[model samples]
Structures are given as C-alpha cells and as structure tokens.
Target chain A: MFFRLTFSSIRHYAFRFSLAVLGLAISVASLVYFLSFGEGARRLIRRSVEDFNLQLLVLPPAQSLTVQPLLPRSLADSIRSLGVGKVYSILRLPYTAGFPPRAMGVVFGRDFSSSLRFISRYEVVRGRDLRDSTVREAVVGEALAKALGWDVGDTLTVGTGRYIVVGVVKAGSPMVDNAVIVPLNLLMEDMGTDRLLAVAVAPPPGKTEEVLSLLKREFPGYTIQTSEELVKLAKSFVALGDAIRFGLSSIALFVTAVLLFAIMAITVQERRWEFAVLRALGATRWFIFRLILAQALTVSFVGWLFGASLGWGLAEVTSRVMVEKFGLDLVEVSPSILILALLVSLGVGLVGSLFPALSAVRMDVREGLGR
Target chain B: MSRLVAESLRKTYGRKAKTVAVDGFSYTFEPGRSYAIVGPSGSGKTTLLYLLSGIEVPDSGKVLYGDTDLTAMGEDARSRFRARYFSFVFQQFHLIPYLNAYENVSVGLYLKTGKTDHGRAVSLLRSLGIEDPNRKPYEYSGGEQQRIAIARALITEPRVIFADEPTGNLDSKNSEMIFRILTGLASEGRTVIIATHDLALAEMCDVVLRLRDGKLVGS
Candidate 1:
C-alpha cells in the first residue's frame, strides 16, 4: 500500500515530476562531462611519464615544470663527461602560444647520433627514421601527420625553417604521437637559439641513485628529477584539475536541487488533504514522511538514468572535437564517472525533499482535513 | 466490543478569541449499541467526536475505552490505537482520489494488518452496492463515493466506527440506506457513533443526544 500510494501520487503529477527530472538530468550531465576531461588528461600524463624510460631529467631550476628551451645545449655534454650514463639534448619549441598547448604542435628536436629513448620506443610505421642528422629532414608522430595530412615526401614548415618528412611514427601514447621531430642542432640553428629544453640521462644498470646524487651535487642550481618525481607531479596536477572541474559543475547541481525542492514543496502543499486522509485512515507520521522521500528519490533515479547517457554522449562529442580541432583527445567517460553521477543525483534528491518530508510529518491532521 | 466512557471532556479552539468547541461533556456509551450526536453548526458535534477518537487532545478530559484512557496516551500511541481498533467515515466521503474503489477499501486493511485483504475489500464494496469497484472516486456519484468510504471503514473490521455526517452530500434515499447500514453494524456487536444534522436519521439509532453551545442539552 505504501509503494502503491507513493507511485500513484507521482503519476498524479507526472508533468510536474518530469520537469524536475529534466532539470536534475542537465546538472548531472554537466558534472559527468566536466570530470571526463580531467580523467583523460590524468591518464595521458601518467602514460607519458611511464613510457619516457629515462632515470633523470636535467632542467633549468625556474623552468623545470615545463618542456621548453630554457637550458643551455652544453648541459648535455657536461652530464655525459661524468660517464654515469648516456646523455641527450632535446629542444621543443611551441608552434604558437595558444589556449591549449597540445593544439599548438611542438617542434621537437632531439640528438639522432645517440638513440633517444623516448623516440626509440615508438615504431616507424611509414618511410624511414631520421637519417643524416645534418640534412633538413624530420619525423612526425602518427597523430600530427594525420591531422596535418603530412606524408613521407611532404615538406613541413616549423619555426621559419622547412624540412622534408622522412618518417611517420606511431606511439599509442598521445603525448609523443602529437609532435614534429627533427635533429637538435639543425632545429637550434634554424630557430636561431643556442638553448635546449632539457638533457635526459639514462643511468647504467643499477646506478640510478648514484648518478642522480652526482648530478644534483655537480649542478646545484638545476633541477634533477627522476621518473618517480615526475609521476608525483603529474598526479598532483591531475588532482588540482579535478577539483576545479568539480567546483564549476557544483553550480549547476545547486540550481537543480533548488528546482526539485520548489517542485516538491508545491506538491506537498497541494496534497495536504490526501496526507490528512491517510493519517486519519491510520497511517503513521513516519509513513507519510517516507512517502514524500520515495517520490523525490524516484524523480532523481529517473533523472540519473537520462543524465548519465546524455553526459557520456556529450563527452564523446567533446573528445572528437578536441581531436579534430585541437589535435588532443582528452575526454574519458569511465565507469567511475557514471557511479559518481548516480551518487551525486541521489544526494540532490535527499536534500531537495528533506524539508517537505518534515512538513508532512508535522502537519496538523484535524486542520488539514478542514474539520 | 469495548464500552466507551467520556468524563468532563473540554476542548478550546483559539488562543485570543478563545472559542470553546467542546465543554464539560460526560457520557457512557454501551457496547453493541448505536448512538447519534445531533447538533446545529458550531455546537461541538465534530469536536466531541474528534476528542473521543483521540484525533484531538482535549483541554481537560478522560475518554476511556474498556479501562484504557485514550486522553493519557501520546500522539503516536493514539494513532496506533486508532489503527488497531477504530475506523472513520467523514462528511465529504474522503476516498483517496487516486485510488480505485477497491483500493480505497484495501487501504484500510493494509493500515490495520500491514498487508491488504483484496478478497474482503471486494466483498465489502459489493455488499455496499458499489457496482464498479475499479472506478476512481471522481467517477462515482455522491452516494456511491460515500458507499466506497463506508466500505473502507468496514474492511478493517474495527470494533468502534465513527461517522461524522456520513451522508451529508447524499440524497434522501442514499441517506436512509447509509443510516440502516451503520445501525446494522451496531446489532452485530460493534459500537457505532454518528454525528449528524438530520434528526430523522438520528432517531433511527438506538440513542440520540442533542447538543447546543458545546454542551449536551437533551437526550
């Protein structure tokens, strides 16, 4: 009887209840859509850090956080003389300063004389690897090639210099698969800069800590970071990004809760006589309270169903747009996101219906029946 | 069947204006009998019914049902007591609008037992001359709606039945039929207390009490 009464009341106000559901659905959709991007970016950064395969990175103290031309090219040789590990200099210049860094493709220049661990990991899917480091030749990642329609013989322009594409590479990881690579010395001369982004050091066998201690002592002014430190930094960045996105989505959730609350409050007012009748018929105050709560939860549960689908659909569209317009795929709708959306929507339902349920419980039965 | 006894019952309505709805009313209602409380407007017929049924707390009173004092119990306790032993029919019929005639009757059974007896509800509705028990309250006429309300009260098989103007909205024909049905329940060993304006229907009960100015005037 309790279940029948609750559902019957909801059906009685079907149109009003549907409006509340739609409002809640939109808020939950925004929440799911926003969090997807943060999750995607976090996953990408973690993969890139893991695949780098080097023991340490030597960066200029102030510019250690970003991958850009801030360290002198001589730092690679200075690190190499120690013989603790092989060294390589990498130069990365942004094509254009833009809102999203990935949209502005990087002019990635690295030493071809020694096999760069980062570049060696991916397979050369077409043409050949960068041969003759002095020649004006370049290699492009699979994503960058596909985005710009670059082929093996295509000529590409990067920072006032032109180079023929010698190879197309595939790295599965988005970070490496979205850059245009060239020889470090030629790129430096073409861009008219004697600086490099950073020097990567591969420690011999089990001498990682020994090499790190030696480098940190030798160049106290620089930042020597291990892969573990880089991963920790990435995790912190992901956490901050998640916090900001969730904060922005909270506004929509608040509005949704208020909308539901208003609708439920009005419904309670209209149904006062019915509640009084039920009480007179021997229903306890707790039963009346639970009936209102059940109605609210039903609305939210339906809203969550529609909202999760809409949010995931929106996330997919955003991912496609980022890939086509910005050359970055950074939106992931995971199972955890759906679960979180459900919990959040249910929370809204509970908050929205609390006052109305209390009012129903505290109603004066005699007055409500108009006796 | 349990005997109902009221001692010096008094109830007030407002704080400033202070309308005394029921005042100094005392009576002993025997079991297995029908009693009618007939009064004009604002004469406390409804308030006295409410006080006796534990729906309202009197300013000063002792209403005992078989040695259990209804006035001494808490609100929830009174509600439980009512659910376990009493049933009510109102002036407006008060059938749950969303429920069908059969569901309305079954709701009473559910309230009493925590589960419904569908067969008993259908039987009661049929006995009360509700031809289409599947119809909602709006589909029924005034008399049919009242019949559905009575069926709801009967489904619980309550020991005491309270009817406050049960046929107020019905025609003369339906009013007599309702009065006969209520009187028949008294013969079957259930206490029936009715508050009504129609003296003709009031005289049909075993005892008729008249009231004026919130106090009993004649019997």
Candidate 2:
C-alpha cells in the first residue's frame, strides 16, 4: 500500500519526474564520459611506456636542444657487458623527406638486424621488414607514412640520399610513430659521423634499477633514464588533463544535485495535503520521510541505469574515433567507473531528498488539511 | 460501557485577538447512545468535537476516556489512542483522492491493526451501495463520498465515532440515510457524536447539545 501510494503520486506528476530523471541522466553520463576519458588516456600512456620492456636510454650530459649531442659507439658494447639485455646504438638527425620535403621530421639510424630484437614495441603493418640488401631502405611510422603519403617501393630523399620505403610501422608511442627509421651504417656514412646520439638498452626483467645504477656509475658524465622514469615524466605533462576532467565532472554532479533538490521540493509542496492525510490516518513522521526517500531512489536508480549504458556506448565510439584520427587510445569504460557512477547517483538522490523529506514531516496537519 | 468525559475544556485560537473557540465546556457521553452537537456558524461545535475526539488538545482542561486523561499523553500516544478507541468522519469526507472506495475504507483498518481485511472492506462498501470499489473519491458523488468516509470510520470498530457535519454536503435523501446509519451505530452499542446545523438530524439523536458563543446553551 505504501509503495502503491508512492508510485501513484509519482505517476500523478509524471512530467516533473521525467524532467528530474533526464537531468540526472545527463549529469551522470557526463561524469562517466569524462572519468573514462581520463582513465583511458592514462592507460594508453602506461601501455605505450611498458611496451619498451623496461628499456633505458643513455644520453650525453648537458646536451643542448640546438646542438645534437654525440656519444661514442663503443657505449653500446660497454652497456651490453653489464649483464643487461640487448643494447642498440641510435643516431637521430633532423631530415626533410617526402616528395615536397616536409619539415620537422627525424630520421632514426638503427642496426637493422638487431633493432627488432631490442625494441619490443615495433611492429610492421605493411610491406617487408628491413633486410641486408644492397639498396637503401627505410621503415616509416604509421603517422609519418600517412603524412608523407608514402608506401612500399616509394622513395624519399634523406640528406642527399634516397631510400625506398620498406615497411609502414606502428610504434604505439606518438613521438616514435612520427619518426622514420633506417639502417645505422648507411646514415652514419651519409652524415660523416661515427658517433651516435643515444644508446637504448633493454634491461633484463627485475634488473632495471641495478642496470640504471651501474650505468650511472660507469659513465659519470652521461644521463640515464629507465622506462619507469620516462613514464612518470610523460604522465606529469598531462596532469592538467586529469585536473580539468575532475573539475568538469564535479560541476556536473553539483548541477544534478541542485536540479534534484528543486524538483523534490516542488513535489513535496504539491503533496502537502496528501502528507497531512497520511498523518491524520496515524502514519508516523518517519514513515512519511521514508516514502519521500523511496521516490527519490526510484528516480535516481532508473536515471543512473539509462545514463550508464548511454555513456558506455558514447565512450566506445569516442575511443574508436580517437584511435583512428589522433592515434590515441582514450575512452575505456571499466567496471569500477560504472560502480562509482552508480554510487554517485545514489548519493545525489539521498542528499537531494533530505530537505524536502524533513519539510514534509514537519508540516502541521491541521494547516495542511485546512488548505 | 465506554464513556468520554470533558471537564472545563477551553480552546482558543490566534495570538493577537485570541478568540475562544471552546470556553469552559464540559460534557459526559456514554456508549450505546447517539449525541448531536448543534450550533450556528463559529459557535465552537466543531471545536468541541475535536476536543472530545483527541484531534486537538484543550487549552486549560482535561478530557478523560474511561479514566484515561487524553490531554496528558504525548502526540504519538494520543494518535495511538485515537486509532484504538475512536474514529473520525469530517464534513469534507477527507477520502484520499488517489485511493478507491475500498482502499479508503480499508486504510483505517490497516493503520489500526497493521493488516487490511479485504473481505470486510468489500462487505462494508457493498452495504453502503458502493458497487465499484476501484472508483476514486473524485469519481463519486458527494453523498457517495460521505458513505465511503463512514465506512472508513466503522472499519476500525472503535468505541466512539466523532463526526463533524458528516452530511453537510449531502442532499435531503442522503442526509436522512446518513442519520439512519449513525442511529444504527448507536443501536449497536457504539457511541456516535455529530456536530451539525440540521435541527431535524439533531432531533434524531438520543441526545442534543446546543452551543452559542463558545458555551453550552442547552442540552
């Protein structure tokens, strides 16, 4: 009977109830979308960093951005002797490539035979991998290939020498995906430099800190960084994204709460006589309070269910577009996020109904009936 | 027999002018009898009914129900007392707008006993000539609505039924029908008190008390 009365009252004011539900649904959806975007971006960055297999990069100390720093090619052998995993020397230089020669692109010179064994994240999506052929060949990242409109058998000028595109690759990381990769010996001869810019060493599992500490001690004048440090540095650059997401979500929740509060207050006022009738029929104040709260829970629960499903669908589509257009894996709807959204909606319901329920219970029966 | 006794009951309303609605009024009502409190407008007939029914406390007096002082009890205790020992029928009928005839009649039973007897509610509605138990109060005529209110009062089987102008909105035929029902309750050994302006209805009761200017003029 209690539930019937409550539901009947809700049906009596269906328009207002729907308005409240819609408002709550939109708020919850926004919260889920924003939080999922933040979580997805973080996961993408972490996965990209982890794909390097705890790799460490050794750079020259006090290297200036305007001047390319060079390290001895023997540094790779020295690092390999420290009981670490495979070590590869890389020489990176800015070079204009493509038919029209696009600007702001780097050419990474690597040992073609050992590069695949050392870099865990590299994967060829098109054409063939680099081989020890007499012809000069290059593997461009997916982004760089798209930008230059280059495919297999296509040739591009790199520092007065042309190399055929051997493979289109996906490096997972945006920075790496934008670069072109070629054989180290060919680039070194073309640049007239035997020195390298950096040495990338994949440390054995559970030996990252040991390798980093050993390399720092072995070469006091060099700068070394493990994958963990690089990942932390990358995350620090996107801290603002997280803060903005949190702020927007908080504002959405606040607006939901306010809208719910206003709707509940109006409902209570409209039903003042009904509450008085219940009181006159020997209903306790607590019973009236519970009835009001029950109405709020019903509205909130339905709204949350609808909003969560809609948000999940939207997030999936958004993630797909991001991956295709921006090459970013941003928007994953996890179970934890769904549960948090549910809890937040229920909390909003509870808080929104509090004042209205109190007012209903405190009404003077005679006055309400008289009105 | 159950009896209601009021001694020097005084009730006043408003703070600035302080009009006395009931002043130094006293009465003793016994079971198995029908009583009518008759008065003109603003003469405190409804106020006296409210005092005796424990709907409102007296300003400066006591109302005793078989030796239990109703005014001394807390609000919840007074409510429980009303649910157990008394039922009320107002002039407005006061039927819940959303509830049908049967649900409205069974509502008091649920409140008092924490359980509803659907069979009893159906029988009462049938006896009162209400065929459709699903029709809400708004769908019923004024007389039919009053009959539903009476059924609600009777469903509790209280020792006393306090009715404040129960037939005020009814036609002549309906008024006579309502008087017959109140007289029938009195014959069944339940006390029935009604406040009204109809002299004919008051005459049908076993006793009549007239009030003028918040004081008992005659009995």
Candidate 3:
C-alpha cells in the first residue's frame, strides 16, 4: 500500500514534495548558518586549551577584565600547589618601535615551556624558540617575521630595546600565528608592570573543573578561570550569536513553512474531488489521511535534501563573503547543523500539511463526483 | 449471506422537519449478481448507496455486510471496512485527472502489497475498450474516462463495487458499452450495485430497485 501510494503520489509529481524537501534543506542550511561560527570557535578553543596544557587559567571577572591582550591577574602559586601538572604566569603588553614609537606590536612574554602551551599550534617556519631572558630575545610569527624583515641572527627593536631573533613558529590558528613571543621578564620589564596578567595550569585529564573549583575556593579576590572556563565563556558568547543567527534564519524558514503550507493547501484544494473519489471508492478516512501524509512526507523529504545541501553551500558562500569583505571569522558549519536544519524543515512541512490533509478528508466525495 | 443488506435504513439531513434522503429502505443484494436502483433526481438512490457503502451513516436502522453493521462503525473503522470490502465508481467519472489510466488504477490499490503490476491495469483498460494507454482522464473521451473509472474499481479486487450513476455523463452509445462491462463483472461473480435511473441498465440487471421520495417502494 505504501508502495502504490508512493507511485500514485509520484505519478502526481505535485512538485510540493520536491519543494518541501528543498524547504527543509534550506531550513537545515539556516541552522547551519546560525550555528557554524560557534561550532568553529568551539573547535578552536578546544585545540588551544589542549595546546596550553594548562589545567587552570586564573583571571578577574569577565566584566572587569579589559585588556584585549591579557586577561586579569591572579595568585599563581596557590593554584600550582593543588595537584597541578604544572603552572605558569602569562603576560601580554602593547609595544611600539621607536623611542617615540614608529609602529605598534603586541608583546607576549612567558616561560618558554609555558608560552608554548598558549601558542602550541605554532611551528617554527624559520629561526628558533625564545632563549633565556637576561639578553633581549624574541620569536616572531611567520607574518610578523615577514613584516619586520629580520631573519635568524638579525636584531629588531622589540619594545624599548633590541632583541635577537630566536625561532619562528607556525601555530595553525591565524590569531595565534600572527603574535610575537618573548621571555617572561622582558615582557614585564617592557610593560613596567609587576603584576602578571593570568596564571595557566595543567592538571591530570578530566579534572579541569575540580581544579578550578578548588582555586575559586582558595583565592576569592582574584578571579580564577581555566581553559574549560574560557571555552565556556566563549560558548556563552554564542547565546548572543545564536540569537542573531536564529533571528535571521527564522525569517527564511518561516517563509519556507508558510509557502509550503500555502502551496500544499492549494494543491489539496485542487484535488478535492480526487480525494472525494477515493472516499467513494471505499477509502477510509485513514486511507485518505495516509494519502495526504505520504504526499507531505514525499515533498518534505525532497525539499529537505535540496534545501540542506543548497543552504549549506549558501552558508559556505556567505562565510567566504564575510571573510573577504570584513575579515570576520565565521566558523565552520557542521553537517549536524544541516541535518538539524533539515529536521526543522521537515517539522515545518509536517505541521503545514495538517489542515489541508484534513480538508481532503472532510470533502464529500458524492457531491464532488456530482460535479 | 448477501454481499449487501439494508434493513429499515433511514437518513435525514436536518433535525427539525428534516429532509429525508433515504427512508425505511430494506434491500438485499447478492454476490455474483448486478443490481441497479432506478430513480429520478432526489429519489434517494445515490443516498441509499452512500449508506450501504458506509460513506454516510444512516439515521436509523442497519446496513449489514455479512453481519458487520456499517452504521455502527466510526469514521476510521468504516473507512477501513470500505477499503477492503468495496470499490466505487461515480457519475462524473471522478478519475484523478492528474493521473494517467494506469496511475489511476494504482489509487484503488492503495496500501495493498503486490498490487503494483501495471500489466493488469493496462490489460483491464484495454479490455474495457480504451485504446490509448498513456492518456489522463482529460485527454480521454468521457467513455474512456468512465472505462478507466471502472478499471480503477476492479483493480482493488473488492468484494463488491458500488457506482453512482456510472454512465450518467455518457451518451447512450457509450452508456451501452459501460453497461456491458458492468454486467460482465456480475457474470464473474462480483456483486455490483449501481445507482441510476437508466431503465436500460435496470432491465439488464438481475434486480431493479425503484426508489421514490427516499423510500424503496417497487422492485
């Protein structure tokens, strides 16, 4: 019965089936559009946290923290005592070239092993890693290297004084790969700040929160955080992100749903007598219902397939466009997002088809046939 | 047991001073026989078929298909009963215009597994004297469309087939052709009940039921 009903529906080729699937696909795409950035950020943060090997990141409350470079400082040693694999202070300061200043640069300083955690993604494309801090030494990002034009053994004025070129590294992330690395004390001397910005700690696997909870309990004045917390903070940013994406995609999906409803309503209306005839021919109300359901499912599935792939592609294009136009990082959209979108579209199609399918059932086949 | 039985069946449209369409009707239609109800407009033949076929519930009394009271069933049960027990043809030919002849046949076979062979559909249509196999109802002549409708009814292999004024839309020449096909079904032992006023159809049937003012008066 499902077989013949399918054939009958296909024979009708009402186009709504394809349209529905397409609508669903687009909805899926809308979902992708809405969630892709968050997905990418989520991925990148996990990578960074893994690279940092820091079990903890302690800082001030997010609202009070204002330096775009360094998060707020915390008591570094208390966190280190709490079964941490290791602990280190991280510092970032704004540096300019001349005695007066020629160009601006962000100078990040830490213990070489510790700094490597935050910048773990980088690979030395040329030169070497940062050496001991008594002598001014620096490791530049590949792009920063290109900009400064100093190779191995060349001296470049880093903050107030000259530093020897050490190793250049490439972290995969564009954000990190573009940064300059220097030894911890020089960064403090360069910034003239005694307070370290934040402390990063590494602990045993899966004990991240257990450690942060302890640090938060031990040191109440300084805001204590971790990579997981940072990821959580970044993830919280997605509430706003999701709201914006949902707002945009809902408009498109709402239109798709309404359009699907209207088209199906019209098609059902047009087929009144056909339904009537089916009823007259001994089709029970259930049979009539199945017919409409079959039609709706057929249309919605086709629409979803088209809409998901097309919408995903559209999302990809839109992300690319944003990248070129504004240099904004739109995250990688997931297949699940597309699948989710498709599911939403199907839901919309199912909801939209309800009234018309009932209408088909209610029509009098005898009167319909009389006409 | 007869294929169809109506025992004192009655149907009235309104509540106060209601309009009665079928009143106090009792009839028994047997298998392997053809019966036609003859009546003028508003004489209740079509309504009576509607009641017996379980498309409409009778206001009073029972329509029994082998002891199952159709009027006792709910919408879903009646519909299921209808799907398995009978097929219908109608005056307007009521063929799905969007579907071709073969596709039209498939509609009648809904939800029935192995009812997929279009070979039987094509053969049946051809047997009914339809020459063009691929045309939809609108493209076919009224006679051909009616033939397709008949073929649709047969495709389900229902126990009984009901048709409301099966040839009412056709010319007498085409009408005679439809009669032959219907009579042939009866000869094959499938009960056929056709609601009509065409005496030519009535004279050929195994029984003729005469309806007047919503009552079965003469037979």
Candidate 4:
C-alpha cells in the first residue's frame, strides 16, 4: 500500500519527476565518465609496473621514465660489476607526433639474452619469441600488430631501419600491447649510437634498497629507482588526477541535488491539502513523511539506473575510440565505480527530500484542509 | 456503541483580530442517530465539526468519546484515535485525484490497519453506485465522486462519521443521494454528524441543530 501510494504519486507527476531524473542522470553520467578515466589510468600504471618485474631502472640524470639515450652502453657492465644483481642494457625511442606507422608507438631495444622476465611478461601468442640479441628481428605487441596489420614474417620500419616481425606478443598491460620489441644491439646499430637509454637490473632477494643505494652512489649522473618506487610515483600522479576529476564531478552532483530539492519542495507545497486529506483520513505524520521520501528515492533510483547504463556505454565507446585512434585504453568502468555512483545517488535522494518530508510532516490538518 | 460529548467548546481562529469560530458550543451526539449542524457561512459549523472530530483542538473545553478525553490527548494520539474510530467526508469530495475509485476507498483501510481489503473496497464501491471502480475521480460525476468518498469513510468501519458540507458541491439529486447514505449509516448504529447550509437536507437527519455566530440556537 505504501509503495502503491508513493509510486502512484510519482506516476501521476511524471513530467515533474522526469525533470529531476534527467538532471540526476546527467550528473551521475558525468561522474562516471570522468572517474572511469582515472580508474583506467591507475590500472594501466599498476599493470605496466607489475609487468616489468625489474628491480631498478638506470636513466640519465634529470630523466624520469622518458627514454633519453645518453647513458653509455658500458654502463651495463659497470653496474653488473657491482655484484648487486645482473644488469642488461635497454634502449627505447618514442615516436614523435604524426608518425604514420603509429603516433604513440615505442621502439623497445631489450637485451633479450638477460631480460628473461621482460620477455616472459609479453607472452608469445603467435609466431616466435625473440632470440639472439644481434639478429635484426622484431616482436610486435598484439595491439600494435593489429593497428599496423602486421603478421609473422612481415617487415616493419622503425627509425629508418627495417626488421622482420618474428613474433607477436600479448600482455595485460597496454604498455606492452602497443610496443615494438627489437634486439638491443640491432636498435643501437640502427640509431648509429653506442649509447643506451637505461639499464634493467634484477637484485638479489631482500637486497633491493642496498643495491639501489650502491647504484645511486656509483652512477651519480643517472636517475636510478626500484620498480616499487616507480610504481608509487605513478600511483601518486594517478591519485592526483583522480582527485581533480572527482572534484569536477561533484559540481554536477550538487546541481542535481539542488534541482531535486527544489522540485520536491514545490511538489510538497502544492500537495499540502492532499496531505491534509491523508492526515484526516488517518495517515500519521510519519506516514506522510515516508511517502515523500520514498517518492524521492524512486526518482533517484530510476535516474541512477539510466545514468549508470548511459555512462558505461559512453565509457566503452570512448575506450574503443581511444584504442582505435591513439592506441590508449583511456576509460574503465569498474564495478567499484558503479557501486560508488549508486551509493552517492541514494545519498543525494535522501538529502534532497529531507526538508520536503519534514514540511509535510509539519502540516496542520485543519490548515491543509483549507478550513 | 459510545456517546460523544462536547462541553462548552470554544475555538478561535487567527493570532490577531481574532474571530471566535466556535463559542461555548455544547452537544451530546448519540450513537445510531444522524445529527446535522445547520448554519450560514462563517457560523462555525465546520469549526465545530473539526473540534468535535479532534481535527482541530478547541481553545477551551473537553470533547469526550465515552471514556476517552480527545481534547487531553496529544496530536499523534488523536490522529491514531481518528484513524481507529472516526472518518470524515468533505464538501469537495476530497478523493485523491491520482487514485482510482477502488484505491481511494482501500487507502482508508490501509491507513487504519496497515493493510488493504480489496474485496471490501470493491463491494463498498459497488454498493455506492460506483460500478466501475477503476475510473479516476475526474472520470466520475460529482455525485459518484461523493459516493467514492463515502465508500472510503465506510471502509474503515468507524464508530463516527463527520461530513462537513458533504453535499455543498452537488445538485439536488446528488445531495439527496448523499443524505441517504449518511442517514443509512445512522441506521446501521453509527454516529453521523454533518454540517450543511441546506435545512431541507438537514431535516432528513434525526436531529438538526441550528448555529448562529458560533453558538447553538435551537434543535
């Protein structure tokens, strides 16, 4: 009976409630769309970090993660002499904007003989794995291969050098999925430089910090960090981005709440006499109050339903577009984000309806009857 | 079966430039009888009905329904009492516009018992000449809408029914029909109090009390 009364009231005032629902839905959709990007970036960073499995990266001074091929090739042997862990030279060159082959592609030159973890992370889904670091052969990531329409035995051009596509690799991280892996020596030879961008080091168990301290002291002109430190840095950057996006979404949510509140207040005022009739017919103040609240909740819940679906659809479509156009997975619609949106929308309903329900509860039967 | 007593009831409206709506009015309404309070506009007939039903508290005086002192109880307790024992009909029919005939009548049962008796509601609407209980109030004529209101009143099976100008908005034919329904409730051994401007309709009840300037003049 309570549900009948509440829902019937909403149905009768469909247009008015629809305005509220639309307002709320737009707010929730914006929230989901914005937050999904943050969630996607965070996951990408975590997965990329986890996939590398390297304890330390040695980059040139003042360089963060960007590839700057200034470190000498002999730095690998110098780091290997420290007895902290095995070291291998790695080189990476990022494509500039408007590169026909791919704009966001990275040419990764890895020491295939020693970087076994890196090789294993990018599983060989087709063709074969890279062997013999001196061979002029390349393994393309699955997404890059799909983007470029490359298969095994295909020739690929990168930075004025051509190599055979020996294998296609797949990984959970987009970083690996959009990469072109070639032998370190061949890439160095192609670039006409004996310099290296970075060195990958595998430390002994429980000796990460000791190895890091030694490398920082020995290679003062380079930026050396463990994989965990890099992951933390990436997470902090993502967290800051998420906070700003959430803040932007909150403004929309506030507008939705205010719109709902105004509508409810006006609705309660117009139906004051009807509420009086209910009271005279034996409805308690609490009953009237709950009826109003239930009506608001119904509106908000319906809005949430539509908004969540629209937002998820938008995220999926945008993700597809991002991957197709830029080779980036830029949106993620996780279950946690859906749950959070639901909880926040319900809270908006409760807050928006509180005053209207109170006013209904406070209405006098005689005055409401207009007697 | 209980008697309703209103002792020296006085009700004043407005904070400033006050007008006494009901002044020292006293009456004993007996069960199994229909009583009509007949007066011109502003003579306090509706105020007296409100005071009697505990819909409005009297400025001074005690309204007792048998052993229960309605004037002494708090607002919520009085509301519960009204739910359990009293039902009302209004001048405008006051049927919820959104609800169909059956839902309107069933709501009374819902309010009283937190449950609905669909069978009882259908039967009551049928008996009241609302053959199609699925129609909204706007679809019904003024007379049929009043019948729906009366059905809502009867669904709770209250001991007392208060009708304030119950036939004010109806034609002679509808007014006559509404009076018949109220009188029938009296015959069923329930107290029925009505406030109206029609003396002809008032005469149909067992007792007609005249009010002038918020005071009872004659019966």
Off by over 4 Å in 1: A83-88, A96-104, A113-116, A119-121, A131-135, A202-214
Candidate 4 C-alpha lDDT tens digits along B94-155: 89899999999998999999999988999999998889999899999999999999999999
True contacts kept of 3: 0.64
TM-score of structure candidate 2: 0.78
For candidate 3, write residues B1-219 as lDDT tens digits: 256888999998867988999889988889999898998999988888888888888889999988898888887688777778788888888777666788887767763433567788889888888777787779988988999988888887888888888898999999988888887788777899988888977788888888999998898
TM-score of chain A, all candidates: 0.90, 0.75, 0.76, 0.89
**DockQ leaderboard ranking:** 4, 1, 3, 2
The Cα local distance difference test for each model comes to 0.86, 0.81, 0.72, 0.88
- Model 3 alpha-carbon miss at residue B179, Å: 1.0
Which run of 10 residues does model 2 chain B get worst, by summed lDDT?
B74-83
Candidate 3, A1-371: lDDT as tens digits: 55555556655755655666566666666677667776766666666665555556667555334464354333555555566556777776664444553334466775654432555556788876765767687777665555455577777665566778787766655344445687777766665666776776766677767777777777677666655566777777766777788788888778877877787788788777777777666666766777776777667777666766676677678766654432334567676676666677667777788888888877876665653
lDDT of 1 by residue, B141-201 (tens): 9988988998999888888999999989899999999999998999889999999999999
Q: Whose TM-score is higher: candidate 2's or candidate 4's?
A: 4
Please report how far candidate 2 places residue B148 from its true position, in Å.
Answer: 2.5
TM-score of 3: 0.85
Q: Which stretches of candidate 4 lie over 4 Å from their true place?
A: A55-79, A88-90, A96-103, A113-116, A185-200, A206-229
Please compute DockQ, using alpha carbons, for every candidate against the native two-chain complex.
0.69, 0.40, 0.56, 0.76
Which docking band does candidate 3 fall into? medium
User: Global lDDT for candidate 4?
Assistant: 0.88
Residue A272 Cα positional deviation in candidate 2, in Å, after optimal superposition: 1.8
Best by lDDT: 4
Per-residue lDDT value at A99 in model 3: 57
Ten-residue segment with the worst summed lDDT in candidate 2 chain A? A61-70
Candidate 4: Cα lDDT at A340: 88
